[model samples]
Target: MIKDLFLSGKTAIVTGGGGGIGRAIALGLSHAGANVLVNDLGVSVSGDSEARNPADTVVEEIEAQGGRASANHGSVAEAKATEKMVEQALDTFGSIDIVINNAGIIRMGEFPQMSRSDWEAVLRVNLQGSFYLSRAAAPHFRAQAGGAYLHLTSASGLIGSTSQANYAASKLGIVGLSRAIALDLGQHGVRSNCLAPSSTSRMTELTDNARKHLMSPEKYEALKRMRAASAPERIVPLIAYLVSDRARGINGQVFGARGNEIYLYGQHRPVRMMHAAEGWTPAQADERLPAGLGAFATPLEVITDVFTWPPA
Candidate 1:
C-alpha cells in the first residue's frame, strides 16, 4: 500500500512550475498537503521571454485537483524580484516553509566558442536565481525555526560534460552553495540539499547550436531512444520525501533521481594521499604523484553517459 506523505500546514514556492519537472513537483507538493506558490517566468527553453504565463496553468491544475495553489511570474534572475516572490508567497499563503529552486535555462556550447552572454545567461538563472531565493527565504525560515530548500542540480555538474560548460559550472556551483547554506542554517532548523535529476523534458531537447557541438553521435541517438521511457513525474516522489517532515535529518546531501533508481552521492573526498616531510620539488612530485593518484583516476564521462540508457 502506498502511504501518503504528510506535509499539512506547510507552504512552498516552486520556481519554474509552469511545466516539466517543476510542474510535476508543484502538484506533488500540493497533494502532500502544502499550499503552493507556483513561480514561472514562462521563458523559452533558451531563456527568451514568452507571452503566456506557465505558472498560471500549474496553479489552475492544482486547483482543479482540489489542492490550493497560487501563481507568480517573477524572474528568479533578479535578486530583488526573487525576494518579492518570497514575500508574495508569505502574503498569499500566510507562511513559507519550502523553496524549490528549479528555474533554469540551457545554452549548450563547447567552452572555446561559447560567448560571454551565453555563459552569463545560464549562470544568471541556474545559479544566481537559486542563491537569491534561498537568501530571501533564510530570514523567514530562521524566524519560523524550520524550512527546506530543494535545488535542481544535474549529473553534468557532478561528473562534468563536453558541450555544456556553462550548464555544468552553474549546476556544480549550486551544490557548493547549497552545502554552505546547510552548514550556516542548520542551527536555525533550516535544511538544504540538491537533486541531480536525469529525465526527459523540454530541456532534453538541445538547440541547433548545441546539436552542432555533439561529441558522440551514437550516444545522442541513445538519448533520443531513452526519452521514450523517461517521465517528468518519475522525479516527484523524491521531492515529496525530501521536503516532508520525516526528512528533517537529511541535509547538505546530493541525491540522484534517474528513473526508478535513487542514488546517494558521496561528497568530494580524498581518494589517495601523498605526503613529503619537506615540500618535494615540482619534478619529484610529478614523478611520484602519478603512480599514487593516477591509479585511482576515473575517465571523464560525457553528458550522454548518464541519460543514454532507457529507464527500466
Candidate 2:
C-alpha cells in the first residue's frame, strides 16, 4: 500500500539530512521514489564547524540502494546558503516538488539565567534557518504549480518544558511561520504543515538527561519508559504521507507522532468568557473569574499523560 503513495519522478530537498530524524526521512523519501538533495553542514549539535561531510553519507546510502541523490554542505541559517541549496536541488534534480525544513539547533538554559547569545544562537539556526529555506523555496513551488513544506516542530512548543525557553520559542515560531505559509500559498496549490514528533534523537536525549536529574526516581523512570516508546522510524511514515498526493486534502495542521500513535492538535480557542456593558473593576473581575473562567481551567498536560499507554 505504501507504494501507492510513491513519489516517482518527484524531487525533494531535506535540510539536516546528515543524521537522526533528517537522515531517516531523506532515505524514506528516496525509497518512495523521490530524487533527494541531502543538505548538511556536518556541524556539531551546537553548530560548531566540523570537517566531515555527513551529507555525502546520506547521498551514498541512497545511491547504494538504487536511488538518485546529491549532497550539499551549507548552513540553512544563512539566506544565501539556503538559496544555493535550492539552486543545487534544481540543478541536479531538474525540479523541486517538496522541501522539508528539518535543520535546527538546541541551546538550553533556565529562563532568568539564559544568556543573550544562547537565545540568539538557538533562534538563528532553528527559526531563522526554517524561514530562510522556506522563503527561498517558495517561488520555485509557486512556479511548479504545487509543492509541500514540512517543518519539524517539537512537543516543547506544543506543550511546555523547563530550561528550554529558547528552544520552545523557536519551535513555536516555526509553527506560526508554517500556518502563515499555508494561508499565503494555498491558492498557489502549495501545502504547508508542521510536525511535532516525539521521536528520540539528540535533542530528546539531552532533555531526558535533564529530567533524570530534576525528577524523582519513579517519575524519571516513567519518563524513560515513555521515551523508550519513541523512535525515529515511527514518525517517517507521516512525512512520506504528507509529501504524497494522498495528503493533498490536509494542510496547515499540526500532528504528533509517538510509537504507533498519531495524534492531531486542535487550534487554540477561548474556552470560557466574561463580559460587561463597559468594564469591571480589578477586584470585581478577580472575584468573577474564579466562578466563571477559573472554573473551566484545566491543568497543563504532561508528556507522560500525552503518551501514556493502555489508551487512557
Candidate 3:
C-alpha cells in the first residue's frame, strides 16, 4: 500500500489542494504519514470566482481518515500569500519537509488569437505561483537541510497541444524553474523535480459542447480515449514515493504518471551540434544548415501523436 510508505514526522503544503489532481495528491500525502496543509483559493479551474472554502473539505476528509491536515485558503499568485502559506504549515505541523506546487489555473488559446489577459492569467497561476511557493519555502528548507519540491508540469508544454499555447508556455516555463531550483538549492539538501500527469480532469475542455463543433470528429474522439484510460488516483503512487525517504537519491528529474505506467522524462540536449569553424553569410548558412540538419529536425507533433498507445 502507498500509505505504508515512510513519510512519518513530516509536514507538506499542497497548494491548490481543493479539488481534482491537487486534492488527490494532498490525500495521498496525508495517508503516507505527512501532516498536510491544504492550501487553495477555492476558485474555479478558469481562475474565476471563489466559492465556499474548498480546502476545508479536504481537511475534513483527511481527519476522517485518521490523518493530520489543515485548511489554508490563500492564492499562490501573490508572494505575500505564499509566504503566509509556509508560515501556516510551520505553525500547523511544526516543520515543513515537502512542498507541492500544484495550484494552477488554465487559460487556453492558440498563439494568433490568444489574448494578453488570458496569457497573463495562465502564467500568473501556473508559472509564477509555483515560483512563489517554492521561493517562500527555500529559506526554511535551507535551514532544515532536507526538503523536496515537486511542481506539476503538463504535456501541453512538454510536447504540444492544439489551441493551448498560453497554457503550454506556462507549463514549460515550470520545467525551467524546477531545474534552476534544483541546481541552486542542491547544496542546501533541497530537491526539486517536476511531474507531468496524464489524467482525466475537470479542466478537460474538449468536452465542452461548443468546442466539440470546432474540432474534427476523429480528433475529439482521440482526446477522449486518452483521458478516459487515465485517472487522478493513478498519479498518487508516484507522488507518494517521490516525497518519501525512499526517493532521497532522486533529484532534479522530470517524471510522468499515466495509468499504471510511470516515466522518467528526458531533458533538452543538442541532438546534433554544428560548429561553423569559420562564420558564413546568411545565404551560405541557409543553404548548408538545412541540408546538414534536416535529418535531425524535430517534427511538429502534439502529445497525442507521440503517446499513441494509451496506458493499460
Candidate 2, clashing residue pairs?
Answer: none
- Predicted candidate 3 versus true structure: per-residue lDDT over 1-312, tens digit per residue: 435747788899999898989999999888888899999899888898777988999999999999999999888999999999999888877899999999888766657988999989999999999999999999999998989999999987898877787788998999999999989999988899999998877786432332566657886687677677777878987898887778888888999888788999999999986766687789878888898988998889877678877686
Please list the residue runs of candidate 1 whose C-alpha ends up more than 4 Å from where it truly belongs after superposition: 1-5, 207-218, 306-310
**What lDDT is reached at residue 133 by model 3?**
92
Model 2 lowest lDDT segment of ten: 303-312
Better by TM-score, candidate 2 or 1: 2
Tens digit of lDDT per residue, candidate 2, span 103-197? 98887778999999999999999999999999999999998779999999988877877888899999999999999999999889999999988
lDDT of each: 0.87, 0.86, 0.86
lDDT of 3 at 143: 93
Clashes of each: 0, 0, 0
Better of 2 and 3 by lDDT: 3
Please provide, for model 1 over 1-312, each residue's C-alpha lDDT reduced to its tens digit, 9 standing for 90 to 100. Answer: 143647788999999999888998899888888999999999987998888898998899999988899999999999998999888988988999999999999987778999999999999999999999999999999998999999999888898676788999999999999999999999999999999887777887664225634546676566666565557788888888898878999999999887787888889887888888888899989889899788788767665664556666
What is residue 62's positional error in candidate 3, in angstroms? 0.4
Candidate 1: clashing pairs of residues:
none
TM-score of each: 0.94, 0.95, 0.95
- Against the true structure, candidate 3 has what lDDT? 0.86
